[model samples]
Target: MPSRHPAEVGYGHVVESYVTRTYGGLPRCLVLNGGRFLGLRWWHTTRFTLHLLNDAAAITDEELEALLGYEWRSRLTAAWLIGVDRRERFRARIGALLLASEVCYSGSAYCFALARFGTHADAEILAAYLDHYLPRTDLHYDQPAALGALLRLDAVLGTHHSDRFTEPDGLWDQWVKGVGRLGYPSYIPTEQRRWADVQCEFANDWSRP
Candidate 1:
């Protein structure tokens, strides 16, 4: 293993810190150092994720699995680590978490990981998530995030899995029913904001093929 930098984070520490963490954050912001990144400052509670990307080389699958068992922020960080490493084995676990929707704010990270995998199987997982959740308009899950990831995979692989969902009167159309009204509490969740931001981060900083 490479020598651990004094400032680099460890996977074990990340898995344990979720017990008292706050402010769910995206991995893109975490590494890119933006305003909304979860672990920007190490002195504060949010720094559990700081230097996590730098520590990716030493991360183990078991460590990631442990992280998956925690709350939303840890799961989000774990998923980001998994996606960044392209650890294909965790695809099913990530899909399961996205489907379970046990908590809020982490669904987008799961979607980002699925998109990172960019395989037909990942598309299927995203499709399955859409099939199960989009119809439940009563619950606001990661519908937009899953839909966006599916569309991205379909475009890359030239498949039509998302066509049915995107068609008129489809689940997505139904889910989008409450947008634009002045007093309506819910609105159509757009994936572009989170999806595009994370995608750009991976493409630009992959250290290239």
Candidate 2:
């Protein structure tokens, strides 16, 4: 809300600088009792989460608009703000981002944002994402999350948009079943855990003498 904030910001800095400038107590992460860093994501820390929530509350349309569709961190933060506030104006942008799937982990956030908007349009967006990405068994993207969001929205809006995808041995079924067949994907680009991938990764880690 302050005019003192810069008109533009760069990768990683956009959300961080905005929150730090607008609110003073933002931490890069929250150190838990186990000595693991909570990391600056989602609502993990009360102080920092409050900072993000407050920042989202005060972010002007201009700031919000600037934050979306840029760096992953900024984009994720922007999606969170839009979803939390139910900013329906940015629904299309979120849907576009979901379809683009360019931001990797950003899909879940986008899906959640659409669900928050809670309209048939939102369900349509989720369905559209599934329709586009569900077939690529070779690529395990956010199909599960997107479909889950669609089902959630369907429940709320009384729409059966998810039925076609969820039918027996359909695309969704193939995806779930085929993942294990990809026993060792040459690349785990998204770092999303796949069928039996945890042990493989763990074996790699353990084998490292």
Candidate 3:
């Protein structure tokens, strides 16, 4: 059954409908009267989609589960956005994320999000699942994004690799070494990454792209 709360149900429908209409298909753009092509910012997309995921707790378990396994990057992006931005907001819905391990990009989104919100215990949950997925791959895995997310989480939690980060010595160490191999250069700091002044150029690029 759908959620009985009108606000919750309405928000859920709004997001579900939007995803159905536009998630993975052709990008949305338009032409201005000045004859300029305009498109949406990745930040806008991430934020809007995140609004839906922020409401994840209100949706039924079934609806939440359905979203977990969605194939498109948009859906996974939504999940990761929630993981990073609204991790505390959806604390109750995390089990669904963990169960979504089989979905293509879902694991990365889920793992990173959990890392962000998970308590010491929650971190343990993520660490348990660490071995199954690798750091980087051409199509799906993004080491920079994942490690970036984890580092951000660590900062938020105010704890270092004390309890949760430990993995079997050789395997986890090898993955860390592999990540180092990628020469993952740091981008702008987190505050810089999101600010209007620093991001204005990329925002303009999105509008033009």
- Candidate 3 lDDT over 1-209, as tens digits, reads 22232234333453334334343343321111111211354334554334334444344444444544344343454454454343455554653455434444444455455555647655445444443444332123433233344444455577653233334444434555565566643333343212212122222233211
Per-residue lDDT of 115 in model 1: 83
How many clashing residue pairs appear in each of the predictions shown? 0, 0, 0
Q: Rank the candidates by lDDT, best first.
A: 1, 2, 3
User: What is the overall TM-score of model 1 with all chains considered together?
Assistant: 0.71
What is candidate 1's lDDT per residue for 10-62, written digit by digit as tens? 45565444222343443432433232443235344334334444445457786
Candidate 1 clashes between residue pairs 3 or more apart in a chain or in different chains? none
Cα lDDT tens digits for candidate 2, 1-209: 22222344433445555523422333331121111212344344345445545655677767776677455555666776676566899988888778887756656667667766779998898888888887887877777667767766666778899889878778777776677587733222123223113212222232111
Candidate 3 CA-lDDT value: 0.40
Give the whole-model CA lDDT for all candidates, comma-separated.
0.64, 0.60, 0.40
| TM-score of each prediction | 0.71, 0.69, 0.45
Candidates, ranked, TM-score: 1, 2, 3
Question: Model 1's lDDT to the true fold?
Answer: 0.64
